[model samples]
Target: MPPVKQQPCPFAPLIFDDEEAIGELSSVVLQLHDALSTNGRCFTTGATEEKAAATRGRIESVLLNAFCTIFGQSPFERFSDIFDQASYLAEHMAKDHIFEDGNKRTSLVFALSILALRNVPVVFPDNPDPKSNPYYAWIQDLVSGKRTREELAQELRSNHISK
Candidate 1:
């Protein structure tokens, strides 16, 4: 078969040095999950609340490992850029498939929420239907490794409020 075409990634990696920040991230992630559940979007496949909380805790641990450092060393002290942080949340949440339903939608909302927390004005193409938007396609491409994280970071930076 011909080589599969790669799509551009819409997120970049981030690193963290603060436990409080990690806690904040975990809280945000849980809040998103709860919100989805309230909206009838999240289905845990019959998992109990304790099980779900355990799963979320595991996710938080993984996130911390990916984004945090034990010592405030030279390379570890730097946190992920805002764009990268948002992208990481979006990509990982979607790719993990933790929720039985609406994982992608949840991921998108999480990403946007991260941006909003940073006071970044997120701009999207004026598309009424998400399935019809190129941005959605781009995110899929990113998840499939068709696009690089650096490219996503550049795109995000270009569209950020600072731009």
Candidate 2:
């Protein structure tokens, strides 16, 4: 008989550390990028990825581990480590599809948490009216495999950022 194809594990929730919960929380944002990328999606905040089986699990584990791995010494750090100058971390997390569902929302919360730590509040752009919002259209472009990380970064820096 042919080999059995195992279905993807979909559970992989991230846990936060007491000392570094802030940065660890940001990891979920990155995980969102992994999730979207798994579904072949991108983000307007500058996140994108390619489709791959190994990529999903790897990102999930990394996200779960981010608390301990990267924030051991710096708990109150910034989001630049993951996002760098391009905000690719968001895309990386979304594309991987680390979780079974709701990865994008989770990531958004994660991003806001980072802002919160800095005393900067964030609100969802699409839900401004609480109804009939097109905020999530960005994910559709990625899920349909229409964009890449590089493309997203350039687009964000070019059109989204106001100088």
Candidate 3:
């Protein structure tokens, strides 16, 4: 039999990296969610440490599925814009079913941390009503594919969002 050749993925552009920093940040996000969620009943209160760790791992894995190229065992995306990267993180985390509770919230915080790491100042709504809050609507738009990653990045840079 002849050897088979691997082909490039058409969806490679929609991936992210599972870095140690993202993993650590996810742990913190999950911990905060567990603590503040539904008075500590957001479903993580009873989860074992192993379960929490596994969730963190899953979050990292989900983030690693983006437009990337592997080089010498290391994978990297084509773009390095801070706003773009951070926005994508939040967008993916929100869309991907990676948590039983506080998924979007955790993802937002996690993504925001990425911005903080680079000192990219951003403003976000503080649990506003979806009907009245543009930020909340923006998130909905993002999940629904109405808003592009670049759009979100622009919003973050503009600081038009309010808490």
Query: Which candidate number would show the highest TM-score if scored against the true structure?
Result: 1
TM-score of each: 0.68, 0.38, 0.64
Per-residue lDDT for 43-105 in model 3, tens only? Answer: 544567787678777765655542233463323244446666667777887787567766666
lDDT of 2 by residue, 74-113 (tens): 3224222322212344454556565555554444345334
Each candidate: what lDDT?
0.66, 0.42, 0.62
lDDT for 33 (candidate 3): 65
Q: How does model 2 fare in lDDT?
A: 0.42
Choose 2 or 3, whichever is better by TM-score: 3
Error of 2 at 7 (Å): 48
Candidate 2 TM-score to native: 0.38
| Model 1: colliding residue pairs | 6-146, 7-146, 7-147, 16-67
Estimate the Cα RMSD of every predicted model relative to the unseen true structure: 10.6, 16.3, 9.1
Off by over 4 Å in 3: 1-22, 36-45, 48-53, 63-77, 124-127, 160-163
Residue 35 C-alpha lDDT in model 2: 66
State the lDDT of candidate 1 residue by residue for 1-163, as single tens digits. Answer: 9999775333323455677877777777777777877877567566788877886776677467547664553222333466766666667777877667766667767777766755776787836466786666667777789885566656777877653
Q: Lowest lDDT 10-mer window, candidate 3?
A: 8-17
TM-score of 1: 0.68
